[model samples]
Target chain A: MTVEKTKTRLNIGADPREFQKRPSWTNEDILALLDEEDGTLDPRIYTDEDLYRLEQERVFGRAWILLGHETHVPKPGDFLTTYMGEDPVILVRQKDKSLRVFLNQCPHRGMRICRTDGGNAKSFTCSYHGWAYDLGGNLINVPYESEAFCSDFNKSEWGPTHARVETYKGLVFANWDKNAPTLLEYLSDATYYMDHMLDRTPAGTEVIGGMQKWVIPCNWKFAAEQFCSDMYHAGTVSHLSGIEAGLPEGMELSDTKIPTVGYQFRAKWGGHGTGFYVGEPGMMLAIMGPKVTEYWTDSEAANRAEKHLGSAERARQLMVQHMTVFPTCSFLPGINTVRTWQPRGPHETEIWAFTVVDADAPEEVKEEYRRQTLRTFSAGGVFEQDDGENWVEIQSVLRGHQARKRRFNIQMGKGRSGVGNKDFPGSIGYVYNEEAARGLYRQWIRMMTEPSWETLGP
Target chain B: MIDEKMRAATRQGDISLEALSLQHEVEQFYYREALLLDRHEFNDWFDLLDEDIRYFMPIRTNRTRREQKKLEYTKDNEFAHFDDDLTMMRGRQRKLMSDVGWSENPASRTRHIVGNVLIEEELSASELSVVSSFIVYRNRLERQVDIFAGERLDVLRRAENELGFKIAKRTIHIDQSTILSNNLSLFF
Candidate 1:
């Protein structure tokens, strides 16, 4: 399908290492890393420095990355500094109350214009030089601009690069590729699953607290892929200790059962995916405790969500749902912990996590969400502790030469997936399946290789 | 427990023998508590905490200088590293002792170096507000090692039990905005 590539003023700065020559991997080499039909993946995808650099340009450069929630920048001049790939960008609220994302770097010497995590600011002045930028990222002042240069030196031409900003419900996203599809188009059928957490109430979702930042030594995709499709880990082993420890009073381990009846949704177009138990809140009860479980399933807020979503399955029964919107953004619906797996390097990921509750919910419910998410999913959370252990161990093992040569077995529920489910959208599969994982890699490959929006856009 | 009156009392000089004895007792309590934690004597360490204890660790943030006082650390009712009450702390203790807590399965060797103790307030005859700095060093499976440095604001209650004091409340202020460790599997 032919499509016109939209013009984007976002300037992805020149590669800082452009002077150095490095070993190259062709598109054919990148394509061979994942065997979609075979469901086997090369380990190098998680370790190679060169491949990681390419991903910064091809995958992260084009995809719409989740930066922050709208609640973070409620008033005009409010801004939050975040990363789109390795490149730092500032998500700022304009004077018109619209949002704009621009590179945090100063155009003069490539120093960051804003250093603080987030706060309201009239303009960002670079610490390196006296260059200043308006809320809209327009170059407003430069040190000795008129005196140091000729009359032809234009101040307007030297502003930091700007990214195309959009919001899906209350979540803000920024994209650098001008040719890429809009955020909604990029999200596609995945919005059905996303609305479970996001569009639950008419008042929409609000972040419960400030962002909790932590570092994990692992590939970013490991966290992304698991959130997209790895419910298998939760049921079989990873969270058993957490569940047993978090069991409600008067309840025994024998009373708790893992839910089997569920569906995994793999987006037909985008790489987004989510898996959830259909009728059981057993896992939810264990992880989020009884208060959050009751509020999520049987409370007035949940009833409103059921009416608002128009699907009982999504609002009430889809318990303990884990999801990823391609590349990096991930969240749990019932647990309500939204996060971005900010890729640091080939071997490390910086996680910025926060909890969100329906804005219209009572104070007690909101406080319950904050407390429960802290206990169950934050940096020191019970379930969260196990996840990082597995990832870090795997990453450590991959340091071996033989380990890098072996292929990962991702062939779970391969031929068992089908489209056009009656209740769910997208390609539906069993909850304990890796069909979504394959879909994630397939889209990753497509984004890595496809050069034009004519082929990549919807 | 630390009221304005108690805070004011802490600043006033009181070099009486009673004060010196109480100071030595509090320091000894901390050293023993650190030893119990380092020895993986979790249940013993658990006994050192009051049943109504509030163990908390706020998530630190990098904010502008003007906003630092209000926004540098997460608030009491907000997201934090460890916002555990007695029941939650019990759950964590239970998880650690269990076989399936993979993060600590092989069991990290930890040494909680606690020092710089100062009595911040004398809340009552039975309660005292104490502040101390600690450096917790953990060495996990193979080459994984982490060092966490933080200051703890604690309210210690004098008890009739053998331990002499119990931690009624503890608020840990870790130095880093972004935690360098993978997970806080071990306690501070």
Candidate 2:
């Protein structure tokens, strides 16, 4: 292969020769360096469009992307407008008691049909014109269907195309690919971790409040990478010590534990466990607030946690802080918040957050849920608001020409990986290993090089 | 002549109280409650509320005329405003006193004004249900702040000494739909 730079494309300085030579993007080729004892990540992964578009097609298009929670659309005609892999989507409850996902764009002029965040709509008429469709995405009326066109204009053919919709527990997922894996299968080992939350309740969890949406100025990766045992940033880019005032009465927490959990498990396939930061429940119960502390001690809290969580004396300790579902979502069980970093441009992403509570919980319990969510994840949240600013500033500096020349480090506990250990799930160091980030970018390299997913599976 | 008339006159409402009587008493009771809050005397405020007091502020949501969706986005299970107990109120106050509580540090100055008192009815022998319109002006460093006006439906009962009607409960009805400012830190 001729080795050189491409002028039109941003030559992110990763050995460009590899892209010219490789025909198929296989897991093995990228996994090749992933297991290398002394390998480094190229910083180009932050900005390369070729790799970005591929990820949109392969990862997001193929993976079970979380559209919106079921609570957002409880009744028939309830609709929420969201995006499924860059395709504008409308998640609505159908007359058949099933959920439907459809392209929000009009079939005629391709204008977006629904512009609002959420509402109960019997039918959506295109804002540009009057092309109307129902919850089922069947074209019922067009302003000029009869007069402007011949009977040859088939309204049936022009109806919005619906995407594949499925659910794991209560989470709704949309797949652009018709032949994608089942939602449960796509979840894999991630299910094992999720069962602790979903199985805890006999009726399953219900989203109490609707979703909270916020935007951050960073690549989607920055938000995704935050779940990968990145506690090194705890004391720097965000607040680890600043918010720790005193707790209520009968509370005690020295600055000993980490705020988020730290665990990384390899999927039966290639998916990994969300590594949580390690904070103790004693601290959370005390500092989070009084109403919250009472809910944690309540019997339902334990009865639910026990069904899915294995019998461990300390399982309900609230120690597993950041229980992330890697690649995109981060579900913090302690605070009961669901947030997604949906990538907008290469440098910007929307941080959509939702607060969850038990559907059957008492009013006091729900009130506590609201308080904890607001204190931790609201617009003026103690933790999130601070980190978002840093993400914005970091991307600003990285995208600058002067800052682009340097390569940053991902090598945490070097030479500590590759050799397997008992406590950790992956073939890396301990549970709080940097191997997840290593694994993520390695997968990135594989996708960038390979053609379509002709080389997937074990 | 006014003092002589007050000693013998009945209240504007019917069915006069058989208990203590003093014109200056009710005004002082309100003034004292405002003083306790303005002074950040949360302990005194806690003492003022009856043990069985019901405190609530339902969330307000914009609903179409046909549908009556409960202001609760959280399925009508939780309170949108303060629904607190004695212990919880004390805990909140403790947090405010803490050194690290940034929102309360150099605290936003506040002044409570009460007027247009309407004695609705004598709820009980000792308890009086009343409504008063009030305006509280609040300002911090960065932003100009003001709470225009609201009516407070209050149940006032004679304190242990029976000197006057002490506020047993207060429910404020704010006219503004939106809480444009951040947190609801102080009492209305």
Which runs of model 2 end up more than 4 angstroms from their true locations? A1-39, A48-55, A235-237, A241-246, A249-262, A268-271, A277-279, A290-300, A313-318, A413-431, B1-188
Q: Per-candidate TM vs. native? A: 0.94, 0.67
Best candidate per DockQ, number? 1
What does candidate 2's lDDT look like per residue over B22-96, in tens digits?
334555676777777777776676677776554444333333333335321323343234445454455555545
True contacts kept of 2: 0.03
Q: For all the predictions, what are the DockQ values?
A: 0.75, 0.07
Q: Give the per-residue lDDT of model 1 (tens digit) for A12-78.
A: 3443453363467788878888887777888889998999999999999999999989998899988
lDDT of 2: 0.59
Interface RMSD of each: 0.9, 5.9
lDDT of 2 by residue, A6-99 (tens): 1134545665566576554344443443332554543445655555676787677665677767877889998777886577889999877799
Query: Clash pairs of candidate 1?
Result: none
* Maximum-lDDT candidate: 1
